[model samples]
Target: MRRQAVSPSCQQLGRPRSGAASRRGVLSSAAAVLLLAAGQRPSFATLIPDAPVVGDCPECIGEVNETLNACPLDAPSCISTLSDDEEHFAAPWQFDGTREEAIEQLISIATGARFDMGLIDSFGGVRQTDAAAYIAKGVLAVVSGGDMPEQPKRQRKSSTEFVPFDGDVTERRTTPGGAEYVRIVLGTGGGGATQASNLSEVIDCEFLFLPDDNIVDVRASSRVQPEGKLGSGGQLALSITEGLVLDKNVAGRQVERLRKALRWDVAPVLTDFNPAFNAEAPVWFERLFDPFNRRNKFQPSGLAYPAEGEGEERPLRLPARE
Candidate 1:
């Protein structure tokens, strides 16, 4: 769950900050104030020198200090005063495979049957596969959750529905830095007439294949404003990273399905947890104040496949392979 910060000037260019971003800004100021009152050195103050300080603040500074010191810096929304770039989330990985193997892995995860089955039990199941068909044509459309009218009434719903969107995928090319990469431009709509006009949700995903480094950098950025929590784009990037290089001892039905799909000789090791996927507070905070840390956490909105005994499995309509 690594984030890239942009300059304040860049953040202010035409795009108004979201309420969540504003709230985070206020909380950052409060944290800075607590740091000043406690006579403790602020680590991130240099990044945000303009943060406000309160005069003669409460004695709760000690409590705040204790919590801040105990928590990990990368915890979701944990001490992140820096404004994230429109490219909200990055999930880079080093794997024991060749560039060709890495490309195959990406394709398998995006279009394979086993991977599709794995997603059925998970949150936000695939409602359609036409968008995925583009991957074979050198374009990948990473579908995220978006709202759509639930038919008959033609009223908009919340951002919890799985609506398919299509985006153009650029051909593989070499970067100026000598790294090979593919750029995927994704957005809601462009798939069908019924798809809502969610141009604001457009995002670009870049898959950078570093030369001789065995590293694949998966970066997702929104074209509109920077993302606060784990949106659909962030989740898709994280899921792709997990599929390619899962760490050892990370147990989940998804992981099991991935193993069966790829049929790797050795299971990949789990090195670090993606903050957007699984954020944890200190043990004390979890035991005493769990709900506070759980705020803004990412939860899967819908399932990928229908449940058992519901009905016969319906075939997904995908573009025929040439």
Candidate 2:
């Protein structure tokens, strides 16, 4: 029989589904993380700690030196990627409070939404076609990766992903990191993409993740060498982009009331993760993220349950994770 390498048991990980899993006190400080390996997990945002590991490249450095990190800042919401379904919601949960309350609220409410990774690029098509097919069928993925942004014509932008919509979206915003822009990706057509290098050179970015937290943060910082020939294919450009772009949907019953009262029509999706991903680390990893979006691609069964009574107002329940 083959012998297995002796290693740290799951119990010795020192992080067995912390706070929210237990549904109790606020989760461990954002600085704390689930230890899968002994050290050096690259942070895609908040999924993995910003701690350094051995043989690491010098380009990607975390926001802070891992000190002076505090609450609210430490709040999980700050770290998570907000979901599109939480438009206009009165956030009943906070990152610093009881984890149970946050979990309870999430479980009680139906988070109506779907997470999908689409394919519209040939360069990455061969690699991601399988994953794309899965999402098309409404299957869920915990984490996904495939292809480079070869589809959607290249404008001037940096990217870690492509959007689901292939055409014009009524509303679009510049992705955080001061790099990504909003543009229509027409299915297989190359629409909006960043500058390119040799078609053969595909940079592979493996992101570390923080599960259970609605707000999973992943990001990277880069620095080009001081000297490299431009025409010779040598350029040192440093760019750090937080992974995951959150697009929200319209929700809530305050359309006319709020429009007239506030003199502004606020779409419900405004309640999602910040339009711009902060370069800083989050304090609470799970509180701000949608439970379903945390570890898998979940489609809520009922985005919004139809009204139960003829003339009664109650919380509009949405979908559940698939």
Best by TM-score: 1
Worst 10 residues of 1 by lDDT: 59-68
Q: What C-alpha lDDT do the candidate models reach, one value each?
A: 0.35, 0.25
Best by lDDT: 1
- Distance (Å) between predicted and true CA of 187, model 1? 1.8
The count of backbone overlaps in candidate 2 is 37
TM-score of each predicted structure versus truth: 0.31, 0.15
* C-alpha positional error of residue 271 in candidate 2 after TM-score superposition, expressed in Å: 16
Tell me the number of clashing residue pairs for each predicted model: 8, 37
lDDT of 1 by residue, 1-322 (tens): 2223355685576687799998998898899899889975455311111111212221101112111011122222111101121112222455566878866675445332233222432224433343344233332222333343222222232335433224445346665566776644444333322222232234334456667777664443333332333331123222321232222111112222333444333323322223333232122234344544432232221112222354333332332212
lDDT of 1: 0.35
Residue pairs with colliding backbones in model 1 are 124-302, 125-303, 125-304, 126-304, 247-269, 247-270, 248-269, 248-270
